[model samples]
Target: MTLPTPSTEIRPDLVLLAGRVRTGLGSAADAAETDGTGRETLPFDAVAVRGRHIVAVARRADVDGWNTSAAEIIDLGESTITAGFVDAHVHPLSGAESRHNALMLHDCETTTEVAERIAAFAAERGPEEWIRGFGLSFDMFVGHEITNEPFARAFGGRPGYLLLFDGHSIIASPRALERAGIDGTRDFGNNSSIEVYADGTPTGYLIESDAESLVTDLYPRMPVEARVTAVQNKLAEFAASGYTSLHQMNMEEGDLDVLRALEESGELPVRVRVSPLWRASDPWAETLRRMIALQGVSGRRWHVEGVKFMLDGSIDNGSAWLFEADTHGGGLEPYWTPSAQFTHAIHALAESGVPTATHAIGDKAVEFVLDAVQSLPSHAANTRHRIEHVETIPDALVPRFAELGVTASMQPIHAFAQRADGCDMWTTLLGRDSERAANGWRIADLDRSGAIVALGSDWPVEEFDGRKIFAANVTRHRHGSDRPAVDPHQALSPERTLRALTRNGWASIGHPGEGVVAPGARADLAVFADDPLSTDPDRFAESRVLLTVVDGQVAHRDSSLA
Candidate 1:
């Protein structure tokens, strides 16, 4: 639990004192509340940062003796400081670009409201220009009312592409489909489909990337300059939320270029590790080769570190690769053409010293990925290959995660956002009996088995908020409702959850010591309104972020902190 000493004492760039700081010095404790009862805990009262690295983290008296009056001093006044959060899996660039021109519909509650909002947004677009919008929730189309008629009436026959909030499903206007040359007769394999009427006319609802790309590919994309500004705006949002680093998943070639430019210009507010996507249309070897080349393209603030593949679609759309279900005709489908392609790609990439992060939601998908990881050569055992969104881990496979050293990169907010009354789109598809065993996040179980677990918001799929993550992991309950906990047994202790967001997330992306606050570590810290360790776990949501510091520089400071 102790950090090594620095070679020499030197003046720091900044000093922070008068706070209860969680230095993130040790492995996660069994439970958050009863941690370090008998063990000697490290003292964390103040911290000193030199350049972009921490120089001292000890009691105030200890840190003060080494530093003179040259550094900028900040008195935290009983605030709490912890390692800045690391969101392991996020898609921020696209979502940030969407905010510039796309019609934001995440706030709408009812179908009528959504239609009304779409109508108003469509009224502003030209007849020929594509009307693009995003953030349409899954529940909005529960009755399958997101057909072409409302879209046609609203857009006045203009081509339009409205992406659902989850990025899995899309409902396009008839004109948009016609413009994209998409007819109902087009078949997109087993996992992906274009919903059509009995007479073979299209319903405008497309599932999975293959089907949705038909119209989205035709939509005019944001220009490079506009995209850069949007990304900058998004970085400000992340810094304000106390995030110091991000594991950017599902990045495109253009997105990579934009990130490089940002890093070169010193505009990046947080450190980024990007995972360029391996599209299904491309050959496995070709994609792996391109992704491997990108591993060398890295800067201090951003880098291409891994490859991302979607093994299956979201569960809400009945596209997830699940086991033989008693109902829903066995919900199982693989996004890759040849199922072996994933294993082959994972091996080739791992052999090149590049890790793979696959999106696997269902139990079968999870198991298949674990098998692929297990099949890797013994030399690649420490590759740290990850299974993104281990949403459902079969009881038998839970222990295998530790044995194989596969990181369970999960999104806890997903459980709170999707589930209601212990039932959600995922559970509704898999009957009640199967839901209990299958809709399991099983994060606590994964930790207990000695497996590494990292948590993230899976942003754009869910809002990015570190406070909500803490609350969600502790309760697994809805924010403002009396709905029962989604899965009480899956709830992790606050200490464990914090480790997942900080140390575990950083290590998963190949930076183990980065998220810890110690000598020779990056100086990224988050200051909260209350001491998280002393505060009640249930009241975590109420604690506000008072300030955020990255690279020993202040990124965000609430006026109240002054």
Candidate 2:
């Protein structure tokens, strides 16, 4: 059962066969090569890996001429091999937990479908057991609303909680709210709301942080063994999908311990970048200190390199703090902590040499982060801070991100899913003057403007499908729908999109030279059944991962590989 150890010599002990390799070396200037074209020079054959690094890449015929005594050759057949995916933003623990429990709402195209799935799950569960589910999209549902009526009927007596796709909203059954001691009328004073019925009774729906916290509290009480099993199952599924690394947003210290235990037991299968949740009452400095102390302790298997700060609420729920009042007319509130508090935290993290990635979903929120970053004293300038979900940005401020060294960590799938509603939201919230300035997945624009755009799936909120996400960036169209596309001019080329998912993603997290198959690079690569570069746009949705290699080790392979 022992796995073979990769050789440590300069000469490779393994050879990879790729049908037509897209090395992702698009332009000579953008790439690290001395060649002027910046285009990827290809051998069109095999890549050699020795130990955890790529040793050489050359033609299939030429590789045999180098050395082969200790080599293990893997023929990729017609598959195109490139760097393994580095998910820029993900909640691996949450995604894994969702994968193991309740109904998945990612595929529910309509409200009726969501209700049906919940009802089915409820029918099978015992009365006292809590019914938990996630990935619901309210915009797609009728009336742009999620009610607990259908859910209450299905699990009328049982406590039930269903989380929105964005993890910012939840529809709780009457029983669940009563169990949480929330009658739907109490406002948490943070814009998080509990929907109430006309009769002054709780409707069983909670919005934003307040709603998500209810589930967070319940998870710890679940059997420790069951939680561990759920995490393992989630990791297995992610590996099967070809993800080699993930940045789990909204994680906490307790969650970090579980990951450490998993690694200690040798049960962890993917590299994790954890960002612990930040709270007003929490000791931010002490948390960072503990995380720093644990650095390299897991031998790079698990590390908390960055801190996550929630600067704004979800845009879908009308809670996203905007620069101006939304046209739809709900009173706007700033979502970030006071500037002084955020600035102090940012400076402390910077001084500690830890990076910060704040969630900013609205123009105002993005502005707040940018302003706070700009105000940082000289000592904090090099923190390489990031603003997550810059869903809407004013044109004048776009270039400032690169100038300030802020990574525009974006989720392309959101653009596709939110196009109809998002466009209207932008126009209404930003006004006619700023409407044309609305930037939605403006990757090409941002790149040209000197900003670094890194792509992420934001999984569970969105499905973690690299190919589909890439397609979404290029086409601005959902998988099967014919709808009003977002700004097509902003679409990125396949090479650019690939880099965002690979090289750019690594760079965003301060890990460079990853996501490529060059010498001195980690031997993490993904092999697909078709040339992603030349494949039809529609076909990208159906593309299957033929092989996935992480650190020169075979991680996932099609059943036929055996």
Clashes of each: 0, 3
Looking at candidate 2, the ten consecutive residues that score lowest on lDDT are: 1-10
Q: 383-488 in candidate 1: lDDT tens per residue?
A: 8789988777667988998888788999887875455542445656666566434457888999999988998988877778877777788788755557678778
**All models: lDDT?**
0.77, 0.71
Q: Mind giving the per-residue lDDT tens digits that candidate 2 earns over 127-210? A: 787777777766554334457776577665877787876677788777777778876476564666777778777776777775
lDDT winner:
1
Please give the distance, in angstroms, between residue 277's alpha carbon in candidate 1 and its true position after superposition: 0.6
lDDT of 1 at 191: 75
Against the hidden true structure, what lDDT does model 1 obtain? Answer: 0.77
C-alpha TM-scores of all predictions:
0.91, 0.88
TM-score of 1: 0.91
Name the top TM-score candidate. 1
- Model 1 worst lDDT run, 10 consecutive residues: 27-36
